[model samples]
Target chain A: MSEFFQQIINGLSLGSIYALIALGYTMVYGILKLINFAHGEVFMLGAYSGYFLASALGVERYSASGQSFPLGLALVVLLGAMALSALLGVTIEALAYRPVRSAPRLTPLITAIGASLFLQNAAVLLFTPNPRPYPPILREVRFTLGGVIVTNIKLAIFVVAIVLMIGLHQFVQRTWTGRAMRAVSMNMDAARLMGIDVNATIRATFAIGSALAAAGGILFGLDQITINPLMGVLTGLKAFVAAVLGGIGNIPGAVVGGLLIGLAEQLTAGYLSPDYRDAITFLILVVILVLKPEGLLGVVRQEKV
Target chain B: MTLVGRRWFCIAGAALLASFSACKKPGGGAAPGGSGSVTTNESSGLIVGHYASLTGNTAHFGQDTDKAVRMAVDDANASGGVLGKPVKLTTLDDRGDTAEAASAVTRLIDVEHVNALIGEVASSLSLAGGRIAQRRGIPMISPSSTNPKVTQVGDYIFRVCFIDPFQGKVMATFARNTLKLDEVAILKDVKNDYSIGLADTFKASFTALGGKIALEQSYSAGDTDFSAQVTAIKATKAQALYVPGYYSEVGAIARTARRLGLKVPLLGGDGWDAPELFSIGGDALNGSYYSNHFAPDGASPKGKAFMAAFKQKYGTEPTGLGMLGYDAAALLFDAVKRAGKLDGAAIRDALAQTKGFEGVAGTITMDKDRNPEKAAAILKIVDGKAKYEATVGP
Candidate 1:
């Protein structure tokens, strides 16, 4: 029973990060109707930024002395990483996607892929192709809840993810730029005629989505204690699947899909053969798609606010 | 003689006859190749071909191996040229891809017409290159490819390093006799042939030695998360966790295991030897033990000499793979000198009869399967360094 509960906690912890990455894919698709294949690399760049941030802030020196990082310093590292990732997201959009915006539909898609490859290789050149140890931010503390094991880092990840998602929901519902984003997502020409700056709104969406992905990256580094250039490839693929599973343009649906995917993955790995965890996760996506094409939480056709 | 011994004798006698007949001809070193074909090199000297990962994710392994191999060649030339001709080397970059490895070997054999081949630190890449070398009847020796399937490519495929089974058994023996653990859990990488091969061999050998496997689980390579597997092990009666995986995954696994509070001595194979292992695993790896070919520190006398020479040449301490590369080249040069020719069959025969040859890594004796039966070094991770533990004899 404790093992079952432990697996659930594990699933939810992983699911939170997946949701963070899925939100990026979902938001980009919601705005431009184009799947940003490079979103995964954005997440990777986020982790690298966090690594740099920690190193620059002397967290590495503090960490090397076997001390847990202070809360204030940890927050600074997280925010700094997110800010840098936002810049990177905007840069990628301006450089890679914006040029091909008015081109053939397949052009942007292909450019997205090329951008993905470029970012991955650039990271290799920038960071070198070695797994770097992410400085431990918080001294690890484990909490047992009714025989189930939960670590402080996992809990923090879960809380941060939920809070960010809720904040994004509120922003989209209540803010002017959010209104412009929704309007543009609904009908770009109509929103353009209504004086909404579609390009800026789309860039903001990338910025927000990328920030969330960065948060996920930091949390992942904290959890796994290592970061690498190609770390995002499979993870990004899984998050992309999560987005599709939740409804590509549905924000809340992405969260649901990510959590479900995480839970399914852990349960399959814990109860059945770990070899089939990936195959089974993909199978669920297929089964869900076959049964309800839109997604569990997604509405058919009427996708926009 | 035993049937196998008699067969070896017959082949050696035939090779001798072939060499004598070739000697009677105008130009020597015209001995027959394995595939009943002959390669004639109009170019100066014996051109030795090498295929390496030169530029890729594993480029460091390539660079290290390349340095040691060239140094070995330079040493040979400094003493005397082989067969009255200076040995010339041509190396191609495989970029750590199997397709590239295959193509590189093909180009080396087909275009350069190299007399002998050496290289490939990775087992999978070695397997890829070895097939072409075997098909073309070119004698190839891998410096550090440790998979059992590598030598199984053909009689032409050989490795200076011990195979996975040998290292696996070494660890298993250490675990049973040294660590004295009767039960353990295994968390392996299903996606890696190295991890799976090592795990399988360790499991079999440990079980044979009267140890019980408490539980078994697996994860794929590139997987950073191991909560499910670690939790399952935590629920078991495991005294230790045997994780036969590469350093990248092994380090992460160790961190997770420690974080989950499943404190047990970790056991691994040679794949766990890397500087990154310390940074990634940190203090989690303190109690873990791994089997390796040789240690950079506490090396044999010959190994020390090779390391000193390597440091003089490259201005850095040599890695275990570097020593293996040097040994592979040194062994090849010795065999070529003994063969007194550039013939594939003669070189192959000479390599097969190798016994008590003092390599920098160890005194190597070629087993019938073309692998070296050697003593392995077991090292424990103390703090951030791999401290030498005990030398386990095969």
Candidate 2:
């Protein structure tokens, strides 16, 4: 019972990161109808940028004393990472996707893959193929709640993730730009006819999505305390699966799907064989796809010929 | 416009022909010295080849080994090269992949005609390269690959580090006698042969010593999450935890285990030795113990000199991998001098008959199987630094 509760806490924290990353995939797919496979690399860059920013700010000097939560420095690093990642996301879109937008859909998909590979290798060349230990922004502190140990880092991750999700929801629902984004997602031609700037809407989607992924990356680094160039490959793939399982392009569904995947993975690892964790996660995806076709929250749409 | 195009096409054709001719000459030069042949220059320099994971996930291992090998070569040349012939070492990066390791060995044997081979810090990569060297009857020595199957490839294959069975026994003895921990949990990397082999040996030895394994869990390499495993282990009443995996996963495991409030000391094998370990595991790994090939904190006079020289050259203390690499190269060079020739068969015979060759890591005596018989060092992490605890012998 204690083990069960402990795993739930772990699952939620892990799921929050997945949800943050899944939002990027869902938002870009919602607006551009493109998978944005290179978003993982954007997340990786964000982690690296945060690492550099923290190092430059001398976070390690204070971290040695086991100080809990260098909140000001951490926030500065987080924002810097998000801003840089947004710029990089836009540049990647302009250089790789925009040129091939009019080409066949497969062409842009291939370009996204190409861009991902290029960025991974580029990072390797620039940083050397070694895992850098992430500076501890929060001191290690844990307290047992009914026999389940909960760390302050975990709580911080949960709070920050929920806050970001809420902020994004309110922005998309209450702002004029948010309405324009929804309009473009619904019907790009119609939205253009309604005096909406489709290009700006697409760019805005990339920027917002990239910024969210950057936040996820930094949080992941802080929690795991390790960052590497290829860290994003498997993680990105899993988050993509999470988005699809929640009905890709659906905002709330992505979060729900992320939590489900995370819970499933933790429960499987806790109860069954640890080796079967990844296999079981993917198995759930297969079963859901076969049974529902559209995700748990996905709506059926009629096509007019 | 037609005339101009024709003239440019003629020039391009001529340039292509010239480049092809230039490339063909080196190809022809390499053919005469193929298949177990030794390539010696006019200066009587013997060609030797090395391959390791210099640019992949395990690049730290390769980079350290490569540095030590270079230092060894420089020392050998300065003190009158092997068998009075200046040794020329050619190293290729295998990128930590088995296929790449095999091809690199092939290139060394077929193209460079190296008299002997060295390298492959990882056991899987060593097995791949060792098979080729064995079939070709070229002597190959590994610096730190401890899996027994590596040398089982053939007699021509050898390693300077003690095999996993002995290392596992050493740790088991330490846990039972030194640390006096009775019940332990085992966390192993299923994908790694080294981890699996070490875990099996440790479990067997520990159980034989009347210590019980309270829990056992497995994870694949490159996994970042160990929460479920840690939670499960936390539920157990185990007194200690044994994590037989590389530093990459072990560091993360240590952090996760500590975060979950499992305060028992963690134990591991030589795979835990790397600079990144401290950085990744941080204070979480304080008080953990691991068995290694060599410990710099308790060095002999000769070992101290080697450490001083290494620090002077590389600006850091030599790691176990680096020390083992120096031993491997030094052992190979000693065998070459004893053989008194650059012949492959002669070197193999000398290496087989090696008895008590003192190396920077330890004194290595090659048994009939070409595996070194030596002692292992136990180190404890205190205040984020590895302090030498004791040396356990087989």
Candidate 3:
């Protein structure tokens, strides 16, 4: 029973990060119908940026009197990561996607992949091509809930994720920009016909998605306390799976998909061979795509032949 | 004039082509060279190529190895250069992805036209990279890849690190004889050939020494929860658990095992040498034991010297990986000096002939398998530090 509950905690924590990253994928896909393959690289940049800022603050290197900002320091790192990641996302979209928007879909797809590789390699050149130990910020204290020992960090991640999801849901449902985004996603031509300023909406989608991914990246580093230049690859793949499973362009679908994938992975590791965890997650994704091509929550649109 | 779209088309074409060209300008390096290939030109200024897990999860090890290699190259160049020709090191990031490693290796051999290669701290990456060198007749020396299959890629592939057979035997011996364990279970990282090789060897050796193999399970590289594996192992009546994998997964496994009320003695190989293991496992791994190439707590004078130098350079006591890399670099330099040429084949012959070559790890002698036949030390975890236990024969 304890083991069962423990797995749930682990699943929820892992799911939260995936959900955060998936939001970026879903939002961008919703607006542009393009998978921002470089979005993962953007998350990688955020983690690396956080590492640099945190290291500069002397958090890890602190001995006796070195500069340390436990609370304010975390905030600064988070804000800096979001800012840098958002800027990178916007610049990449402008340089790589905006011009090719009208070109064949294959063109931008290949470009996004190329951009992803470029950013990944460039990061390796700029930073140490190594995993920097994420300086431990929050101390772990296990508390028993229903006989399950849960770490404070895991609980905090869950709470923070829930808050962020709620905040996002409200933003998309209540704001004027949200309606514009919906219109743009529904039909770019129609949105433009209605004076929706489609270009600006697309840019905003990229920015917001990148920011959320940055947050997820930061939280992931905080949880594991280790950051590597290529950490984003696996996480990105998993989040993409989540986004697709929940319906690529649906916001709520992304959240549901993230949690489902995370829980599935944890349960597999908890009950079966941990080696097959990722394999199983990917297999399920293939299965879902084959069975429900439109995704679990996605609306099936009829072709206007 | 409705010609505004044409301007956009030209701009997009130029930008897209620029990015594509940048990516395609450099292909992956060549295959591993054979013992008689003259692939490098010393007179033209040597290009030392390195293919490592430069951009992924295992990038930390590759980065540390790279730093040590650069340091060695700089030091060698400062000392009148290698044979009056300055050494230039070119690196390719494998991203800790296997396919990427093959491309990186190809580019290093074919495009960079490197004289000799040093790389791939991870056993899997090295195995993949080694094949490229072996197929191309290039000399590729791995600093710390411990999987036995790494050297089997070809005679051109060599590692300064001891193979899993020796390390695995050392761990098994420690568990059966030193820890007095009658029964043991093993958890290995399935995605990694190194972990699987080491675990298999340990199981074979442990079972041979009157110890029962209670249960053997597997996990991938990034798995965080181990409740089911632990639960299954708990029912097996095992007295010890052998987990051969990197520190990331091993630390999580250790903590999860403790939480499951299984206090058996845990054992592992050198992959548990990362500093993060201590932070993640904490009190969980207090009584665990692992076999490593070099123990930071070694009483040997050479070990002390290397530790001191490492501290001076990195401001932290070198992990076994760092020390192994330093030794590999120093050994490679020795072979290069003895071969008296920048030719890949000549240097490989020199490497094969190495005997009584002293290093921080120990005296490394390449066997016929192109693996270093040297002793490894057993480390016992005490208060988040790996303290020396006993040095066992190779």
Candidate 4:
């Protein structure tokens, strides 16, 4: 029972990170009806940017007594990564998606793939091909809840993910821009007719989603304490699965889907062979899709001509 | 009446001119001894090429090997070069792709005019490259690939590392005799030739050594969850488990196996040498052991010197892969120096005649097939660190 609870906590912690990243995917898909394959790469770039920021700020540099400086560097790194990632996201959508906005829908999908590959390889060229070592900031701190051991950093990550997710939900459901986004998503022609800038709304959606992914990526790096050029590939795939599993164009569904997938993966790994962990994740996704094609929280919308 | 005859004459003249020009080949220069402009010694300068995965998943291995070769070549050149006229080293990146590896070897032989070659970190890639080298009669040495059939292709194929057979025997002997385990379950990686080869050999050796094989299961690479397989293994009442694969899968497996309450001792091969294994596996990997060519701590004077220099250069202790790369480079240089000439045949003979040559790993002597017959060391993981346990003789 103790082991079970521990595994659950592990699952929840991982799921929360995935959920944050998936929200971005779901939000972008909702507004644009296009999968931002490069969103995952944006997450990777954010992790690297955070890493550089942390190092530049001497977060890991030991003092004379072997103690690190306590200057809120982690927060600084987070803000820096978020800002840079949002900029990159806006640029990607503007250049890649904007040009093909009126073209065939398949064109943007292909361009997204091209952008993804470009970012991945360009990262390889820009950074060292080898994995970078990420030094931990909050060491020797642990919190035990119901026999499940977790560190302060992990708790911070979970707290931040939930807070950001709730903030995003509020922003989407209550804010003026949020209504504009929903208007655009529901009927782009009507939204444009009603004096809404569909293009700007789409760009805004991408920026928000990308920022969330960036935050998730930073947290993931903090969790794993390593960064690699291809780190985003698996994360991106998982986020995509999370989006699809929750219903691609549904925002809340993406959140629930990400957490469910994360739990399923962790629980499977804890109970079964680690080799089947990824296979089981995919298998569960298939099962869910078969049982409920509309997803756990997805609203099946009727297409109105 | 005369027009038809004139046209036929002109067409015949054009045909004769075209055939005359086609008969003479272009750039037909320098037939052997044609210029007699051979003032320089042509029989001694040898060019050795390397084909490695330098730009993909396993690029680190190739990059390290390339660095080692460069270091060795620099040292050799400083000492008056191989076979007198400095040895030239060229490289091709296979990108960890087999098709690319094959074509890279073809290019190395045809375009680079290399006399000998070394490379390929993985078995499948090595085998693919080895076939081309063998058909073309080029002597190619693999630095890290350990599958048994890697050298079985032909006389020209060889490896600096121990084969899977010996590694499997080492693991089996340790499990049966040291661990005193009678029933063991096996987990193999299906997609990797290296993993499958070692697992099959370990199974054969384990069952032969008075150990009962409990169950055997397989998993493909890049798989992260193994709950179904772990549950099956747990039900088997086995005392130990053998997981033969790379570090990535092994780390996740070790963690999951413990979580499933099936904490049997796990055994593996050299692929478990990555730094990520300990962090990912954490305390789950304690008491596990793997077979490798060399351990940095258990070093002879030469090995110590090499380790010191490597640490001085790289700020970290060199792993077995790094040492093997260094040794392979040194061995090739020694052959080049002994031949005192760069001719392909002379260098091949020099390599074939290598005997009692000492490397940082161990003493190496090439057999008729050019494969090194050397002992292997068993390293134990205690407290997330690898310690040399014992050495198995040849």
User: What TM-score against the true fold does each predicted structure earn?
Assistant: 0.90, 0.93, 0.77, 0.80
**Chain A alone, TM-score per model:** 0.96, 0.96, 0.94, 0.95
lDDT for each of the candidates?
0.85, 0.86, 0.79, 0.77
Candidate 1 per-residue lDDT, tens place, A166-200, comes to 99999998999988989988989999999998899
B1-394: candidate 2 lDDT, tens digit per residue = 3575486468557656764453223222212244334544434456678897877778889889988888888899888787776677777778788998999899988887788999889999999999999999889999999999999998889999999999889999999998888899999999889999999999999999999999999999878889999999999999999998988888999989988989999999999999889878878899999999989987778788999999998899889999999999999999988988777888899999999898998888999889988899999999999999999986
lDDT of 4 by residue, A1-305 (tens): 65576566667777887888888888888877788899889989988988788778776574324686464776787888898899999989876788788888899999899789878867876684555645455442566665445666658778998899889889989998999999999989999999998888988898888888889888887665456788888878887888889888888888888888778877776566555667876786788788987777788889778
Q: Which is better, 2 or 3, measured by lDDT?
A: 2
Which candidate would rank higher by TM-score, 1 or 3? Answer: 1
Model 4: residue A192 alpha-carbon error in angstroms: 3.6
Docking class of 3: acceptable
Candidate 4 residue runs with Cα over 4 Å from true position: A1-9, A62-72, A138-158, A266-293, B1-44, B78-80, B175-191, B199-268, B272-290, B304-318, B333-355, B367-370, B380-387
Ranking by TM-score: 2, 1, 4, 3
Where is model 2 more than 4 Å wrong at Cα? A65-69, B1-43
Candidate of highest DockQ: 2
Model 2 chain B weakest lDDT span, ten residues long? B23-32
Off by over 4 Å in 1: A102-104, A302-305, B1-43, B54-60, B296-298
Question: lDDT winner among the candidates?
Answer: 2
The digit string of per-residue lDDT tens for model 4 on B1-394 reads 2574476468557655753443222111212222112223365365667877666656666766766666566667778776566666667777778998998889778866777888887899999999999898887888888998888888777678788888999899988998899999998988899998998889899989989889887777655445446656776879988988877668777866765567788888888876767756767799888988888778789988977877787777777877887788788778767876655566677888999989888888988767789988888999889999988877
Clashing residue pairs in candidate 1, if any? none
lDDT of 4 at A86: 91
For model 1 the TM-score comes to 0.90
Q: How high is the lDDT of residue B144 in model 3? A: 92
How many collisions per candidate? Answer: 0, 0, 25, 19
How far residue B258's Cα lies from its native spot in candidate 4, in Å, is 9.6
